[model samples]
Target chain A: MVVRRPGGRSARVRAAVHQAVTELVAERGYGKFTVADVAARAGVADTSVYRRWGDLEELTADVVITWLTRTSPVPDTGTLDGDLRTYAANVVREADGPAGPAVLRLVIALAAAGETGARAREQFLAERSRQLRTMLDRARARGEEAPEVADVVDQILAPVYVRSLFGMGPLTGELADDLVDRMLGTPGRGPS
Target chain B: MVVRRPGGRSARVRAAVHQAVTELVAERGYGKFTVADVAARAGVADTSVYRRWGDLEELTADVVITWLTRTSPVPDTGTLDGDLRTYAANVVREADGPAGPAVLRLVIALAAAGETGARAREQFLAERSRQLRTMLDRARARGEEAPEVADVVDQILAPVYVRSLFGMGPLTGELADDLVDRMLGTPGRGPS
Candidate 1:
């Protein structure tokens, strides 16, 4: 099972650590930020930080999980295209913001580390897959999606990921809508 | 502009370096493979390795590029679904191999490391985008795809990535065929 450590370090301490990690990530990027710096900024002992989270990569994963839970998987809106467009637009919008790019950098490095890093990445992906699976299950229950639509869902979601990881192109609002329309074969309609 | 120091080293030397890097990646993962290790394994001078490639990450990217070029793009069998299924199945087949998982681990890591590793990543993404765009263009020209089918391509491809990076599940052959059918919205098919 995947381990997710606690974030509440006595409210005040947790807030400080979070703020410190965020600022450092923004300033230096994930590659430059160290657990030592994070600890120093958080005013906690390095051991204390490690005690709560096993390592910097895992800790960063925890932070990413928290942020993703709050920000991503977008709203359902009862339409796949609309949901995807919202999801894609949301990524661009958020990524352009302060925390977004930094988070992206950190997670990539962690994931690449292999083993531990890969596990962290899986944790993040699980959240996304779970969200999609939930929506698919709901649609199945409601008879909104055909029995075979699960594969369609996989196809429909590929571009958002390709654009993000592979630097293919922008995930604009229009592109997102078009992707859903094309995949679902319901041109000009939102998910319903 | 992104720096791509191609063919700087002799073919034999480059091949040797890539081989060493591949072994190192498979055994220890990308994060653990340092320049010195690669240099020693390749029987090349450390300075030569550094002079040709700026860092371990850049070296990893170059090696990957070499690998991909050797693999070439999947051949067309006329139909879009056939092409995609071939492509997807190939990915699954390759990923199960030594170089496949090794390269995948590296790619996932690079994707996760957004800003801190910008230049190297930009080059990586550009390569991938170019390949996909070429395939999409061909698919469009062949009329195997509608005007909007490229979007479906992106969506269909995402799960392969999700599985690779997150370890959510295997990119099974069955899933690949199903994805192609659903995305194409062929006759006699439901959303399944």
Candidate 2:
């Protein structure tokens, strides 16, 4: 079967390349890997990857940076708790495919890999920090009781990321709801 | 200047090997590197490393597992809050040395690198989790209001590890103190 795209081929090429990298990293991780492998996996000419990215590290950086920047928008599900729960669940589900936690592990490993990785890590942190700050601001604008932003960020969100890295239990909406209620100084309805 | 130690030469050799590996990772990031390089840096025979650990990844695991297991003892500062603060400060200071965060980055990278790494990573996490459970149990025995253990662990300790991994900011006694207080439901001394 043959498929055709409506838009420019480059966009589809970029998408295929990155998606292939994600799958490879999730399966075998980043060690002793090659860009040629990614190119072949994408069904693109190895020359396209070689001409553009040059190496595995640079190619990995491009894929991670794209994933970080292109995640879903900050939610506005009416209530602060509702938005938080929805977003947290969405974040978890997005990475909870057949790949399991390999995608998240690969992202963290890439960020800690080297100079190229350090750059991606910092950019991802900065981008996510902005998203959190914006979501908090939006919640406050909606007349939600403003909570301690740093506490919510460092204490609540950090755990989610850390535990995710360890593949510790499932990332649940109940867990997100507990975090939201705790941050807002409200009692949860106990696990239903 | 030659100094002699009372311990056997094997102990001295192991110490030098680990110390050399740490220094190398700190300076070079854990990119493509070799065990022969580590042995050369440590002034040990490459065969000694090859005989004990088959590859750079396994050797890397040894260095990190030793570091994680031998970190500061859990503090017993009378009160749970005081103990938590002291231990947290101790953890932060331990990683704030010449090797800096690079050693940590390397450890995490090695853990995610392959099968040997995955085993080492699990060992490290399990060891730390046991230590935390023990500490929380001691606090409860001492009449502290027992909060949810997983929540307490996730909220108070996870941030410390997350922030350390990211090099996000300085880990301070003040920060640890606040985490302990927050877990205990005590109002922070300032900026709520």
Candidate 3:
């Protein structure tokens, strides 16, 4: 891992604190956690946690943002249907992989807690939206889709988040492709 | 307006309790509010708070579930595109209405907090997904869309939730309709 050294000790301290926050939240839930617990778990000074972050919410946002940055970009397949299917497949792959469910559960958990948690959820969603838009724009530019695909993209891809967050149903590769093709209205293969 | 019973004390009490939970969550946030505070705000006996719900998380879930059930259903326009546009428009209307931002903010707040909150968030999404599926299925049954439209619907509509929860952009009537047409790939004066 490339260590961030610009802020030196502060950066190191922040990393430790963030790791602790994620772990503690996972283990105890946000309502049950405290800054003191985070500080202890991180093996850092309590003053450090207080000095670095105004509160746990800000700290949580930073940690999530950093984690999100590490996620891979959506693949380019030169076709809207192919691209969306690929994207949905990636979502499923991530969900089946290690950091996926944890982060998702964390977000859902936070959202359930109420306002502060809600803000964190919104921040995370905003970041995802920006990324999705970029991917969609690229596809549109590549002539993989009509210029008007953005609206459909939102509707087509919503099930993944719904599945991930709500545990409602399976979001598999086949389902993803089916969804994409249906929304695209791919001739005989559309909808039904 | 209409009272449930003669005394209607129980209904009044529930309403008061729900209102208190919403306000406390909005104010101090879920993290800071306790059962005692919720009871005090509702002007109910503390024992009642404990008796009615096993714990604070459960109480929060009840209040949220109640609120979600009250959200109006999307209309039937006898066409998939029209239905979706109406659905999206309805969602946008609610999201922008009086209770929209606050309730949304609250759900995100709790879900972000941790496991119990995550469970609550899942329930919230479940209700929404169920309602959405019902509407979509009816449209498909009417041959407005193919049988495969379920997945298509999932894909096209997921972005709105993604944007809403994440605070990405405005999901207005015109924008929603545009999205509906794009995902459905229908030609018209929809999104370019």
Q: How good is model 2 by TM-score?
A: 0.71
Top candidate on DockQ is 1
Once fitted onto the true fold, the runs of candidate 3 whose alpha carbons sit more than 4 angstroms away are A1-66, A76-84, A95-98, A101-157, A183-192, B1-7, B27-37, B46-61, B74-86, B105-157, B182-192
State candidate 1's TM-score: 0.65
A1-192, model 3: which lDDT tens digit per residue? 976668887778878998998898767766678889999999998888878777777778777777765664566787766666777677666664557656765665565567878777777666766777777788768866542334433544456665554454565676666555555554222222
Docking class for model 1 is incorrect
Clashes of 3: 40
Chain A only: TM-score per candidate: 0.69, 0.71, 0.71
Lowest-sum lDDT 10-residue window in model 2 chain B: B183-192
| Prediction 1: B-chain TM-score | 0.72
What is candidate 2's CA lDDT for residue A67?
67
lDDT tens per residue, model 3, B66-150: 7755764656787867667676676666665666656755665665566867777766666666777777788768866532434
Interface-residue RMSD per candidate? Answer: 6.9, 8.9, 8.4
**In terms of TM-score, which candidate is strongest?**
2
lDDT of 1 by residue, B44-155 (tens): 9999889989887788788877776566365577766667677667666565444664575566556555664466666765676577666667877986543233443454
- For candidate 2, write residues A74-123 as lDDT tens digits: 67788877777676666655544444345556655754566756666665
